[model samples]
Target: MMRHPFVLFALGTFAVFLLLHLAGGRQYVGVLSGTVVGGAGGAGLGLLYALAWFGAVLAAPVLLLAGLLDGALARASRARP
Candidate 1:
């Protein structure tokens, strides 16, 4: 059975969370301006922030273009003699 895109995205997100949690458990800290803090938390937070920013900035245009391309391809296929 084909899984939905959102479902796949959720699974991928969960897997990344699990991997990050297991790898270090947030003991280490990421360095910024020679300061130390929770590494996993900092990295995870940054990654999530970046993903959210990118989704906001690019998701709509990308999806719209994908839909238009799919529609065009579908039309071309149907036009085939």
Candidate 2:
């Protein structure tokens, strides 16, 4: 699983999202609703947090599926001969 590039990428994406969320990153996400929680410096951080959330929500599952498929195919091919 971890040997596959897609899997590793998905894991990395999820890890980043988790870390940010744990570090009170969600406060920044309020920016999306025009709430701006942390002031001037927080805008960029908010954008980053939003992007990370999107990536975790949208890209991570696809990546994990791709990785699983790739790993299965590799194993099947190796076992054939």
Q: Candidate 1 residues 1-81, lDDT tens each?
A: 224454355445556555555665334333323344555666555455445445534564465556566667777999999
What root-mean-square deviation over C-alphas does model 1 reach?
A: 7.2
Global lDDT of each candidate: 0.52, 0.86
TM-score of each candidate structure, all chains considered together: 0.36, 0.89
Worst window of 10 by summed lDDT in candidate 2: 37-46
**Residue pairs in collision within model 2:** none
lDDT of 1 at 62: 60
Global CA lDDT of candidate 1, please?
0.52
lDDT of 2 by residue, 1-81 (tens): 258989999999999989888877878877888888779768767888789899999999999999999899988999996
Give per-candidate clash totals: 2, 0
Query: lDDT score, residue 68, model 1?
Result: 62
The Cα error of candidate 2 at residue 43, in Å, is: 1.7
For model 1, the stretches where C-alpha displacement exceeds 4 angstroms are 29-81
